[model samples]
Target chain A: MTYCLGMLLKDGLVMISDSRTNAGLDHIAVFRKMTIWNEPGDRVIVIAAAGNLAITQEVIHFLHVGVTLPDEEEPKTIMSVTSMFEAAQLVGAAVRRSYRIDGERLEKENSGFNCSFLIGGQVGGDKARLFQVYSAGNFIESTADTCYFQIGEMKYGKPILDRALSYDTKLTQAGKLALISMDSTLRSNLSVGLPLDMAVYHRDSLELGMHRQFDEHDPYFAEISQRWSKSLKDAFLALPDPSW
Target chain B: MTYCLGMLLKDGLVMISDSRTNAGLDHIAVFRKMTIWNEPGDRVIVIAAAGNLAITQEVIHFLHVGVTLPDEEEPKTIMSVTSMFEAAQLVGAAVRRSYRIDGERLEKENSGFNCSFLIGGQVGGDKARLFQVYSAGNFIESTADTCYFQIGEMKYGKPILDRALSYDTKLTQAGKLALISMDSTLRSNLSVGLPLDMAVYHRDSLELGMHRQFDEHDPYFAEISQRWSKSLKDAFLALPDPSW
Candidate 1:
């Protein structure tokens, strides 16, 4: 299981991903689920994927090497795309390429070719956009009403984002919300662990302002985790313990 | 969809269930998910069901009507059971009866005969026990270590329970926690709605207390929901905002 979230706020895009993947509890590994493509000042795209690591990696590989469309003679890659939409299309096309190759074999073996990505970036002149790209190679863009997308182990961390987030939220605030969300998920699920890859992109800056790694002992996160737990308990105690 | 949770604490049992049942979002109804069989001073059993309304209704009806186990010619039921374990078996047997009659037909129709129940109560000298009876009719008792069971739309409300609950929690406190859990779920899911049925049974006390229906305007619940939401927001805002 994994938890990845991408927020497209007025100030910027906030991306957070937990770096734990497991075939089973005993087979756990620290697999970074986040991928960043940066041509600083020109384009910066961050993609976080969860589900079927093989399929996700293959899609990324396809994106890296480029893929020729079903009827087209030439290949289009993320690096070669003109718009963020085109970049999303290229990523989706790569997913399709992976489907064409191993999807059937996986199904034959009773394994799903499951994968999804949260893609966000700015290219050339258009404002930054964020999308949730699905395993089927289709995607949906985030609008003002829905300024965020979460993939994998989503439910456990969703309430906070649903209640507190909006496009106008400050980048730092959005990052804090994202961490709080992640903290909730990590506390509830063992499948999602730390050594988080968090990147905060300032809308038109096209540069990652804060791309940091967080482990179990990361001071700020530890403080937030401990503090959040204490705050919640304190809050629970502060509530009138039912008079029933 | 539904959301029901049963927690067995050192002080007692906390059971909460939402009454919203929907064949689809277009076909919604308020069918209470909770039922209680209390023969004061003798036994008390609370059952909460989720999934396949028809199947759940049939199972409950079977329990309501009592069942004669094969080879044991007597028709024993929750009211007749002398121990919580036997009461759980009666509930399980009721589920199996529903399966025996309609499972195949539903399977043929591609609609799963799925339903689960949380059965918790005390009978005679047996301490209060909580069992999560699955669709297969097999059940697992809630031990001190794993003290809670949730069926349907559970994740959204899981974090608070994971953090705030312990075996020693008072019945009223557990009830408050359950309501808070339900409040979180209601905010996140439209399918799980109001008019929740909450039952908090203290150990050794066969009579039910604080059994209430929390509708849109139910005053006590209104206070709980409002205060709880405000506290969460206050706590969230109080958490250190990101420095980056």
Candidate 2:
């Protein structure tokens, strides 16, 4: 299981992904799920994935080499895309390619070929964009009305995002909200562990603004986790109890 | 879909259930999911259910009338139970009876036999107890280490309960936490909605302590819903942003 989140805000984009992967209780392992393709003054593409590690890794490999999207003769790679929408299409194509190779075999084994991706970045002259690509290779772009997308173990961390995040939120503040959401998930689910990969991009900058990995010993992540828990307890206690 | 929560606390028990039931997006109605049988000075049994409304209703019906547990010669009704454990067993028996009648048919129809109940109350000399009965007619009682059980649409509302609730929590405080949890679920899920049924039981009382139905227009429920959202936003804002 994994938890990955992406936010498209006025200032930029915020993406976070947990590093824990488990085939089962005994097969847990640390695997970074975020990939960044950065070319200063040109484009910065960030992708966080969740699901079968084999499928996702294959998808990443396809994205890196190239994918022949439907209705196109030549293959396109994520770094070679000219627009954010094309970048998303390339990711989706990669997913579909992975499905073509492994979906049937995984289904036969009852694994069901589950995988999804959050791709958000700016390409050349285009504006920043965020998309959630499904296992079926279908995808949806984030809009102003719903500027955030979360994949994998999402429900436990969703309430905070629904309450606090918005399209107009500042870039750093959105990052804070994403970490808070991740903290809620980490506390409630054992499958989603520490060592988070995060990338923040400034809109139209065509370069990654901030990138960091947070482990159990990261001071800032530790502060956010502990302080958020205390704040939530305090906020809960502040609410008036029912008089009846 | 539904969301029902049961907490076994030192002061007593707090049980809450949302009233919304939907067969599909178009077929939604208000049907109370909680049933309280209060035999003053003798016993008080509150049962809250979730999943496959028809099956849950049948289970409740069986509990009301009678169920013959395996290896038992005669049928035993919930009211005839001698202890809280017996009451839980009776609820489980009722679930099994419902499954016996509708399980196969539901499976053939692709609906599946899905139903679960949270039964909590005190019988005569027994201490107050809470148990979660599964569709298989098996059940598990709550202990001090884990004193809460939630069924149906549970993940959205679980983080708060995991962080703030405990067996040592006061009954009213636990009730507040339950309501807060429900509020989170209602916001994030369309299937779980307005008009909640709540019952609080005081240990050794042998009677329902506080029983209330909160509709959309209820002032206290409205206040909690509004204030909790504001408080959460405030809490999120209070956390520090990443320095990077």
Best by DockQ: 2
- Give the Cα error of residue B191 in candidate 2, in Å: 0.9
Measured against the true two-chain complex, the DockQ scores of the candidates, in the order shown, are 0.73, 0.87
lDDT of 1: 0.88
| Distance from true location, Cα of A164 in model 1, Å | 1.7
Task: Flag clash pairs in model 2.
Answer: none
Expressed as tens digits, the lDDT of each residue in A135-178 for candidate 2 is: 99989999999999999999999998889888999988888888
Q: List the residue pairs that clash in candidate 1.
A: B10-B167
lDDT of each: 0.88, 0.91
**lDDT string, candidate 2, B34-79, tens digits:** 9999999999999999989888898888877899877898998988
Q: Write out fnat for all predictions, comma-separated.
A: 0.69, 0.88
Off by over 4 Å in 1: A69-72
Measured against the true chain A, the candidates' chain A TM-scores are: 0.96, 0.98
Interface RMSD of each: 1.3, 0.8
